[model samples]
Target: MEDIMRGRFSRSMITVAVAAAAVSAVLSVSITRTLGQAPAARPARVGGKPNFSGIWQANNEANWDLQAHAALPAAVTQPGIYPYDYARVPAAPVLALGAAGAVPGSLGVVQGDGQIPYKPEALLIKKQNAEHWIDRDPELKCYLPGIPRAMYMPYPFQITQGTDKIHIAYEFSNTARTIHLDKVAGPPDDTWMGHSVGRWDGDTLVVDVLICATHNLLKLFRFGWSPQRA
Candidate 1:
């Protein structure tokens, strides 16, 4: 009888140990799940509408291209010491470099002089473009001026919003406006702004420029193509 009592006590102790081990495992899983899944982060919203209220600058070293500037290579894998928030943007060569070939305005921008971030082929193209810009951009050649170029002109521009339509007015020569938003791509007419349509994604304004001037001219691009050394 005593031996039977000892066996029963030992069995009960083993059962308690198993239950405690099971509880510990379950607790660990629950804690891990709770910590790993984070809450979704939402963009800031205002006035039942998304607000895009940042001052955009047109003057930067990237005016020539979107990659890198002189002493700033396209293949650079690390950040530089200078603060280049707006400087990453390409700036026009003539404007960045003064008459004496001095980079007066590009002190914080170009680690070297006013030279831009360009591949060899692109550099050749830019040199040709600089020579002919007063006469022949794709817009003047009757094609869409492309998205980023139009957005980053030296002349100031503005964006106004209505219930369904958004307007972008340029201080450049064309005096053009992009009719888009409200899911509108505009009529099929080719334009410098190229049927730009915009929409709101959270607090950001998403704009799509259709019929970009990759290889063609717009009906509005009536400037004579100068036999000027293309």
Candidate 2:
């Protein structure tokens, strides 16, 4: 019985020693692991200002047709590619060509029933404009697509922001907008891009735009920014 007790104690001591050795090895490995520098630093405010520096873009069909719409025929169509060979052609050439550039149906992003509010006369003008959009659209004329329109255009834009100024460079028409943070004054001129003044409300940037060329063009826009890095 004495020999048996001694054997049991020895075995317990051996098991405890093995467990201790395993724990020590694990801790040693954890300590020796190489933790390289993080790939990117978290976004931080400089001089107590929001950092809006980034490439941003809108993903929607707003650029094509602003209102909610069903699939529509393409703007332009040409004769069949196989002009002489009528037998090989499946159907009308316009139908085949139109299928490629047809605008996909969208529920639309516009607020309130996805329709713009216009007076009777203005609505009539808009309908006429829509009929002649190919020729009358401001975008086709290489005009600076104005606000709200510029924000959601189907192109990416880069924003470089500072405490005193914010610069937005758009991919379309190489257009851009400058938002002054300090100066308060009347618009120096009436232009497509317009004049902007900006202020911060928490992390949200509020910009007041004035386009003197058009009536009642004072628009206030807000852009909220978060510091979480992706």
Judging by TM-score against the true structure, name the best candidate.
2
lDDT of 2 by residue, 124-144 (tens): 655555544454555655667
lDDT of 2 at 105: 67
Per-residue lDDT tens digits of candidate 1, residues 11-31? 999999999999999999999
Candidate 1 at 185: error in angstroms?
5.2
Q: Which ten contiguous residues of candidate 1 have the minimum total lDDT?
A: 220-229
| Cα RMSD for candidates in order | 20.5, 16.4
Best by lDDT: 2
The ten-residue window of minimal lDDT in model 2 covers 221-230
Q: Per the 3 Å backbone cut-off, how many clashing residue pairs does candidate 2 have? A: 0
- Please give the distance, in angstroms, between residue 173's alpha carbon in candidate 1 and its true position after superposition: 1.0
Q: State model 2's lDDT.
A: 0.63
What TM-score does structure 2 among the candidates reach?
0.59
What is the lDDT for 52 in model 2? 77
C-alpha lDDT score of every prediction, in listed order: 0.50, 0.63
